[model samples]
Target: MKRPEDIAEQFQEAWNSHEMTALAALFCADASFVNRFGHYVRGVQEIVALHAPIHETIYSDSTMQNEVISTIALGDDAAVLHCWSRLNIGKAHPAGPHSVDTVILAVLRLLPNGWRIQALENVTLTNPRTGQPVLRT
Candidate 1:
């Protein structure tokens, strides 16, 4: 919360901890998010709702590592950034143990409390020719 660039680390921590409240606290009340699967939702409550179930189900044993790709300051109160995230999924889910790489684009605003994400979109890395998911190098 000290810096906008730190959001990626915070997200990774929250996700790994499986704490939806902690994750929701990182976003603005009216925040918008689009998951790698193309599901879109607006507002922190909706965001929490969208993620909470998954944490207990498909993503129960998932851990994520996020690396900041770039951060651009839009102004004193706003910024945009991309984070490369690698997710290690556990075998508890139906898909079995697997890994996924995604690029997350986030727009953050300097709220009164601290920096909060206003919008975020996650896209899975895929091979263009094969149209299949690709692991990050």
Candidate 2:
């Protein structure tokens, strides 16, 4: 990646393409992730396992748009970033064709090759009062 901030764009592309291998390449071998539905897993392989099926099923036709909200350098080798993403749910998804907004917090580490995600957490935007998913605020 040319810049640390580029991870969001890479993620967006990989997700839209439904290429789990490409997505796995963006993370470290020991990377950890928490999906919007609260499913947590450690290691890139596990992450791939968790995501691969979804792309074949619920997310087959989904497309995501991600905007980098912030990127904070923790040190020379580490950084933290928040990306706001909007996903257009596919017809195959149980939710049907709908759009959802989410915030993704990712920790990135500058590796020998480049920057890779070390940990990530995704949370869906929701209405606090109604406990319903929020398309937008």
Candidate 3:
């Protein structure tokens, strides 16, 4: 199967399950992840550690869906993918559920075992109303 397709499936399954081990498996040993807020986490072990807390708290009730925008193959052993995802992290804050829209650029390496994310950067798009309506005192 194509790398994008495989990763998408893996993402959906692992994210929906909110399982640390499963999510970490998709990344290469030296992978890195930058969350929407620019929180940088590197290495598979760190990735697992970072996700564990969120999955148990703010992201516990969340669901994620990825939309692949493009995939560029680098010869036969690497590929770059640009994709976006809608994270229903509605319960994370007391403000109520606000689905987050995030864009991700992932570099994948085709290893003997299959494709794994070498690095993934995510940036969240703030809603137009973000920091708007200067609150009353």
On TM-score, the leading prediction is 1
Query: What would the per-residue lDDT of candidate 2 be over residues 1-137, giving only the tens digit for each residue?
Result: 75789999999999999999899999999999999999999999999999999899999999999999999999999999999999998799986899999999999999998999999999999989998988865
- Per-model clash counts, in order, read 0, 0, 1
Q: What TM-score fits each model?
A: 0.98, 0.97, 0.86
Report each candidate's C-alpha RMSD, comma-separated, in the order given: 0.6, 0.9, 4.9
lDDT-wise, the better of 1 and 3 is 1
Candidate 1, residues 39-129, lDDT tens digits: the string is 9999999999999999999999999999999999999999998999999999877989999999999999998999999999999999999
Candidate 1 clashing pairs? none
Q: Report the poorest 10 consecutive residues by lDDT, candidate 1.
A: 87-96
Predicted structure 1: lDDT:
0.96
TM-score of 2: 0.97
Residue lDDT tens for model 3, 1-137: 34654786687679889988889889999999887678898899998998888888888888988888889998798899887777776566566786767777888999888889988888776546783322111
Candidate 1 residue spans exceeding 4 A from truth: none
Ranked by TM-score, the better of candidates 1 and 3 is: 1
Each candidate: what lDDT? 0.96, 0.94, 0.80
